[model samples]
Target: MGEHWIDVLPVFSDYWINGEVFTCQVDPTAQAQVSPWWQVPQRLIDQLLKTDPGPVIAQALQQLQETRADLYGRFSPALLEMKIRHLLVQSHGQREGLMARIVTTLESE
Candidate 1:
């Protein structure tokens, strides 16, 4: 059998630059146990990716990149991605998830 990005569904790695968290792109072709693969929790997978949140997330990300490149460039892709994912899960309510956690962590750094 061969491993793919889908096989690693949501694995990631985080780093910091000027206090913002950034997710490093993990090589999905590599073994799961290799570096840069942070096994995301089932809970987050449910909140962010389950039930095909693709359309909503894709729209949000695209719009942001197009309309707000300056601000977008200020933040890390991982942080921006997390913020959009959080919006999808929370949906006009109190948002809580990796984005919140990372934001809190970043503020402290």
Candidate 2:
């Protein structure tokens, strides 16, 4: 069977201080239609974050590297490298936010 493909639609949502929310229009130049395999690194990183203490950057980077190696043929090398770096940075930001919340909760107790 041929590879399964999915369209990547970027959605931008905005929430105002008054509780109003709206979805922004999609940018035509940023649209991409790719296979689900391209999302493996993101999915893996998300799963790792579900653990009790969360995952280390190395673990997420390793997972991304492995996924890129396995699916090298599906995407450009440069694109895959860029995706890996992007995911690592994104994961770091998420971990920092979680840690801040935990610290705040603990301090209040």
Candidate that scores best on lDDT: 1
> What TM-score does prediction 2 earn?
0.24
TM-score of 1: 0.36
1-109 per-residue lDDT for model 2 (tens digits): 1222112323444434248554555566764545442455776766665553223535433554564444444555456445544544555546545333433333343
Residue 16 in candidate 1, Cα distance off native in Å: 50
Error of 2 at 29 (Å): 69
Q: What is the model-wide C-alpha lDDT for candidate 1? A: 0.57
Mark the 10 consecutive residues where model 1 has the least summed lDDT: 93-102
> How close is every model to the real structure, measured as TM-score?
0.36, 0.24
Off by over 4 Å in 1: 1-50, 92-109
